[model samples]
Target: MAVKKKLAVLFIVDLIIIWFSIYSAYYFRFEGKLVEPYVNQMFLYCAISSVLCGACMAYFGMYRKMWQYASISEMFAMCQAVAIGWALSYAAASVLSEVRVPLAVAVRTLETSLLLVGGVRVIWRVIRLRQSSGMDKRIPTLIYGAGDCGALVAREFKGAAMADHKLIGFVDDARDKLHLTIHGLPVLGNRTDLSTLVEVFKIKEIIIAIPSVPRSQVSEIINLCMASGVQIKIIPAINDLIKGKISVNAIRNVDVEDLLGRDPVHADLQGIADYVHNKVVLVTGAGGSIGSELCRQVASFAPDKLLLLGHGENSIYTIEMELKHKYPGMLFEPIIADIQDRKRIEEVFDTYRPQVVFHAAAHKHVPLMEKNPAEAVKNNVFGTQNVADCADKYGTERFVLVSSDKAVNPTSVMGATKRIAEMYVQSLNASSRTRFASVRFGNVLGSRGSVIPAFKAQIARGGPVTVTDPQMVRYFMTIPEAVQLVIQAGAISQGGEIFILDMGEPVQILKLAEDLIRLSGYEPYIDIPIHFTGIREGEKLFEELLTAEEGATKTQHARIYIGKPEVIQQEDLYVELQKLNNVVLGNSEDLKDVIVQLVPLFARVS
Candidate 1:
């Protein structure tokens, strides 16, 4: 209704302008003395001009545009509409009127009408901008880049919805752009000047609008802003921008993932698509962090069908709904079955005959698995054996197991089981036609039981955040980064090889806790105390990506390396598994000892 009223008002105003323009043209041409014949035909000329011009304006969608956010395209449209309207109006007047309208008068009328019509919109847009930006309470904000993305951010802030923010200017690093103006906002200075600028301008908010740069650079800027004690926001990642365009709604708070100081992962797109496209892909534990991310990335390649298999019904249902919503046209089948149940696993394999299998189902939490060693073996060892055997039986082309850095010289029951799982797949690959491999990486930053969420929860409670140990350190990567490399590893796998991802650097738990505290707007040990608890059972000071016995060699990808495959005696592995199976079924207590025989590097934490 408001739009209708606004359009009606604009139409009435345009009609009046059309009539006034014709009269003005004649007044200017006859030196303020109106000629008799022109005056007599003025009413007929006005009627013809108003009707034709109004129709042209409607056809050009002039009244439909939100002039408050007008651009050059809107002005161009207005010019075209006015010119076409007058051309048609002149033709009609020459044919239907007794006196011929002067050619000079016709041209002058078009020029006058265009100026008045276009001027009204431009003035309205300027007035709206002034009214919105005139807010006295709007927070003074500074955009951290003066490039394309920064200019886009400035443009979005001009809307009424963003009236709460008053853009001061941009801060750019390029020497040439340092003093230039972008979108009428000046480029203040580089990152080093942030603190002084914040103090001088009393800047309450700083928006990091440099989305195309490396995250490390962003992290550096964020740290600089941290010293300014101002609220900081960042634009979405380059790929996350909608259709490669930024919106003010997409501005978000900086996350711990950004603090990792790593660039976005670049996967071998064609390689992954080649194997995954049109193939029946199956992801075990598809509801879990790594598994769900795998499903999302794989869905992009347009798989024939993505089988989401998990033990928990709720988790499986959640992922199924998500996939269905995200990839509506793609086929997705959510299966609720346990990998530990051999029959159920076999049934799923027989039904789908999935060409690509990503085995991510396993017991992973170190402390929990320490207390429940037998369950860990049942799921991580025997469960994996069941999946791999089915893959072999069903003639699957490729099978990739999601292993962990803990699997190397494992100190925990969980890690030992994962190591044992890796061994089984390697042994199976020797005889099976399927290419079996494993992707081993360190701790996923935001996985279900990872330390990141624990720190956040403690911080939210306004108390001491707990750290396992001050000295304990582990390599960390975001969940998406890990899953991307996992898929890429699958694309480049040969049978029996274990691929290790480059988990940038080992981060100390103490430093990580401090960073999290600062990111949460609290000073460590001052605002939020950090307490160090001794390391838990089955955890180590550091995790190794590869055991000394299995040295690594560089792969085709810079971030991936191939660990030398260990030769496993197939008969010996079978006998040990049989004994372990008996121990589990008999409820025996020697589970850890039996696991030692399978993974010789297993070191009992006790």
Candidate 2:
């Protein structure tokens, strides 16, 4: 109703604008003397000019736009309408041999029309600004981090009732930026002054602006903001901040994923789309973080067939069922099979002949894999070889293995096994007819065993939230974003390329746990106990995405990087692999040695 009324009011104003434009144009062109001769007949000229002006405006589409989102297109249309209307008025007086108004009338009318239209728009917007000022004034928002995203958040509130969040200042990670102003919002101080800044500004909300900052840092800021009894909001990732494609609607609240401290990498969208579009694609571990996300994105590109393969009955069935419901026509198969078993994998591959494959199945728990290295080898190493070999044997076109940052300078058996698997896939690509690739990234935001869930569960249980070590930090990425990039890498891949998806920065685990505790409407370390547990065996202070010996060259995609490593002969690696396979259980003592030999950087923790 408000929208309709506003439009109706605008319609009457548009009519008045058209009349005034032509009348003023005549008055300015013909000085006082020209008007004196035809002064008595002026009322008739005015009436005719008004009718002509209305017609010109209608023809030029002057009333079709709304002022709020109205753009240059409408302004241009108004210019054209004024031109036509004023020109017609001058021509009628000259041609009809009646009241003669000079041509300058048209130019004056043009200027008047522009001012009237533009001024009214600015005035209307200003009126709305004043009306919303109280609400905007009520909530003084302090945005943390002074970057491009921070500047955008400040702009969002200044124009309209969008978020109604009044910009106060910025609280950043570096003290060097303390006195800097972004988009007119001052950078009050570094993160240390959060409590004081909140009180001083009477901040009602804190918006996080640094999308590139490690999740640990983001979490710490969120905790500080929350502790002051103020709400916290986080800007969306770079992809969501797409220029002009999206509006302030995308400037959203801080999510659980943000605290996980993960960032997105670039994926070769066209390459991935080409391979998956209209082709049969199968992903193992379908219900897990990576698999489910792969399914979600694959469905959008119109695949002819999709196979959700996983051992866990519930996970497979749920993801398969969900994808099927969303994409009704696509042929989706939910397969229950252990990737480690030769016969079962053989059966699935032969029956499906899936064109593209993403082997996501693995035993990724570090400490668990450390304790039971056998399971890690069987699942991560042997399972991967089985999938890749079968994909080659069955004439499947592409096979992309999902690897981890732990695989770089690995400390745990899980990382070692993954590294070994990467070697086999790379080695196999050299000789095999099928193209195989590996996507190595870091820990995902909300995977089955990620720290975010653990923290949330601990925080919910009340009291102690456990952290492995305050100093321990790891690179992270959002599962969905990582999965999209993984699929993209798979689509673009040809032959044996090892792509390391960029995981932005490392974040401390303790800060993450503390932030999660605070975001849940609690005071950190006081309302929630943070229990410090010593680092687990085979766990290190940090994980690496690239080994010291290896260097990376980024792909056309910003997030996807290719690692240059010396390629080994597939025949030689096969011989060593065969001996290890024969003594999978018998050589437990030498297993660690064999793994390090296979992956030179697969170091054990001190």
Candidate 3:
């Protein structure tokens, strides 16, 4: 109802403007003296022109436009409508009357009509913008980049009804763009002048709009902004924008992963599809972080059937519902069975015969595994053996074990068990038809029991976040990134290869804690006290991806490397594994001694 009323009012106002414009043109063209035929024909001319103009404007949807956000396109549209209306008026006047209208009068009327119609819309737009600017409490913002992205962001801030940011200016490195204006905002200076501009404009936030640049450059810009103590946000990449996954309102806070400054991982899509497409893929521990991500990526390839196998019913159900919602047409089967139960696992394999298996089930907590070595053995070592044996027996095409960096020069029982699992898989690859490999990397940022989660929980409780050792450092990667490389590794697997991901530089745990505190909008060591606790049992100061014995060789993918350690003979490995299995079930006190014997590098903390 309100829109109809608005349109009616707009039509009436335009009619009035049209009538006045025609009369003024006649008065001006006659040189301030309205003579016989001109004065006599003025009312008839006004009526005919007004009706023609109204019809043209209505046909062109001129009244339907919201002039508050009008642009050059709207102005052009109005001009076209006025021109058509004037042409029709002159034709009608020539046909209906014996007296011909002067050419100057017709041309003057066309010009005057266009000027009145176009000018009102533009003025309305400017007035609305000024009124909105006065009413809105906009935050002073600095846009980093003077290209298309920067200009789009500025326009969005100005015209978006819900936008709360007021763009002060742009900061670009292009020499020629400096001091130039975009969308009425000047390119104040380059990034080097960011600090000064922040002070000059009292900038409360900085939006980095250049998504095509490398991560290293983005990190550098973020560092500069951090120094000024202003909040930072980033635009999503071009690909995301093109896919309709992001918009101006989709801008988000910078994550810790962005600080790594590593280039985005480009996976071998053809290789991944060759193995995953139209194949039954099973991922054990499919409810866990890495396992769930593997399922998602596998589904993207349109697998014949994705088998989500996990021990926990809730997690399995959760991922199942999510996949169903995301890929409603894709087929999936969710199975709940513990890998430690050999009979159950073998039965599942017999039924499905999945061509590819990603084994991610294991006890990952160091301190917990240190206290419960037998449980770790049953789950990590024997659990892996059960899965690998089934894959071999069922003629599975590929088996990828998700290993960890702690397996190298191990200090913890969790690490030792992972190393033992790697050994068993490598040994099985010798005689098995299934191509077996392992992907070993370090901590995932948001995985369960990782340091980041612990720190966040501590910070939430308003207590001192604890650090085991001031020097402790470990390699880290985002969960999705790590899973992508893992899938790629599985695709390119020959046999018995341990693929180590190039997790950029190691991050100090203490520094991570401090950064998390700050990111949570708190001052480190001031708002939240950080306490240094001595290293716990089964913990180390640093982690290694490869030991001295197992040197790395490069692969086709720059981020993945192959490490071929000295393999244990299958017969000998099975014999040792049998004895270890008996010890695990019998509750012997020599558990650590047996583990140390198998993994010579294993050291038990006293």
Candidate 4:
């Protein structure tokens, strides 16, 4: 009903405009005097112009446009409608009446009509701006980039019906754009002037709208903005943007991922596709963080069939539904079977006979696994054996174990179990027809039970965020980056090689917590307090990607390297595994000693 009323009002207004434009054109063409048949045909001329102009305006979508946000495109559309209407009306008036309307009157009418139609929309837009400007005093905000993205963001704020922000100006790095007005907002100056502008304008928010630049550049800008002590928001990188259009709601608070300062991982697409494309691939622990991402990335390569196998039925069902929705034409098989069940594992292998396998299932929490050493052994060590033996028995082409940096010279049962899993896969590669390898990396951001989520939860509760130790440090990677390198490792694996991802400089845990607090719009130690809890059982002050005994050699890819650790004899490894199995089955308290026998480098910490 509102639309209909708007259409009716606009149509009536446009009709009046057309009639007045025709009469004024004729009066002006006659030099302020109306006479004879030309004066007599003025009403006929007005009627013809009104009918043709109204039809052309509707045809050109003039009535459909929201005049409140009228722009250059709308002006161009109005011009086209007016020009076509005047031409048609001139032809119709000449044929319908004996006294022909003069050519000057027709041309003058076209000019007058275009001017009136476009002016009215602009006036309406100005009136709306005046009304909305007085509606409320919005927060003074500054956009960080003056490029295409920044301009779009500024326009959104200026043109919105009830925008909560008032765009003060833009601060760009490009010197050429400085002092120029964009969308009625000035390009105040470059980044060096950001602090001064914020203070002068009493700015409340700084929006980083440069999406396509390098992460290091963004980090630099963010660090500068942090000095100003205002809320910081961002337009996500181009890769992160939604497909169709960017909205004001898409402007989000800066996240820890943005602070990582790591550029996107450029995987060898052809290499990954060669191994994953059109192959039957299986991913264990498909409901967990790494496993689920593996499924998403593998599906993008158009695999013949994707097998999502996990012990948890809900996780399996979730990834299965996501894959089905994401890849509507591809086939997916969700198997709810634990890797520890040897019979169920073999049955799955016999049934699907997947060409490639990514074994990600494990018990990985450090302190929890320290208390539950036997369960870690049962799942991480023996469970890996069950999957590897089945892969070998079923003739799978490649098997990649998702190992961890904690596996290097471990201190905890979880680390030792992962190290054992890597050693077992390496020993099996020597004798099995199926190729086996391990990919080792550090903590993935936003994973289940990771420090980032824990810190976020603590911060959300508006209390003291707890840290394990003031000096604790750990390397981190985004989940997609880790998974991409994992798949690439599978492509380049030549059996028994442990691939170590190039995790950048380790981040200090205390500093990370402080940054999180700041990113949440709070000052560390003042607004949100940090509490230091002593390091828990089975954790390290620092994590190593490769042990000293297993030095890394460069691989073809820059971000991935190979660690040729010393391998154990197949019979000796199985004998040790048998001993570990007995300890776990007997529920012996001395499980750590047995784990140490298998992994001599493990320095057990009480």
lDDT tens digits by residue: candidate 3, 1-606: 887887788788788887887788888888889888777566777788888988999898898888887877978888888889889988887666557777888887887777777777777788988998677687889999988887777777866652667778899999999899998889999988988999988898999999889988887887678767788888857664553234666677877777767788899999999999999999999999889998988999999999999989999999999999999999999999999999999999999999999999888999999899899999999999999999999999999999999999999999999999999999889899999999999999999888888998999999699999899998999998999999999999999999999999898998788767766767787889999999999999999999998999999999999996686987877788888988998999889888887899998777
Residue 472, candidate 4: C-alpha displacement in angstroms = 1.2
TM per prediction: 0.75, 0.65, 0.76, 0.76
Clashing pairs in 2: 25-105, 215-261, 266-559
Q: In model 3, what lDDT does residue 159 have?
A: 64
Ranking by TM-score: 3, 4, 1, 2
In model 3, where do residues sit more than 4 Å from their true spots?
Answer: 1-137, 241-246
Instruction: Output the worst ten-in-a-row residue range by lDDT, candidate 1.
Output: 236-245
lDDT of 2 by residue, 437-504 (tens): 99999888888888888888887899699888889998877877888888878866877888988777
Candidate 2 residue runs with Cα over 4 Å from true position? 1-197, 200-229, 234-253, 259-268, 585-590, 604-606
RMSD of candidates 1 onward, in order: 12.3, 14.7, 9.9, 10.9
**lDDT, candidate 4, at 283:** 97
- Give the per-residue lDDT digits (tens) of candidate 4, residues 1-606: 897797688788888888888889988888879887887688888888888878898999988888877888989888999889888988999888778888888888887777877888888889978887677478889999988888778777866642778788899988899889999889999988888999999998999999999888897888789778888999987854554356877788998888787788888999999998999999999999999999999999999999999999988899899989989999999999988899999999999999999999999999999888888999999899999999998999999999999999999899999999999999999988988999999999999999999999999999699998999999999999999999999999989999999997898999889888888889889999999999999999999999888898999999999996685898988899999899889999888888888988999787
Error of 4 at 338 (Å): 1.5
Model 4 error, position 147 (Å): 2.6
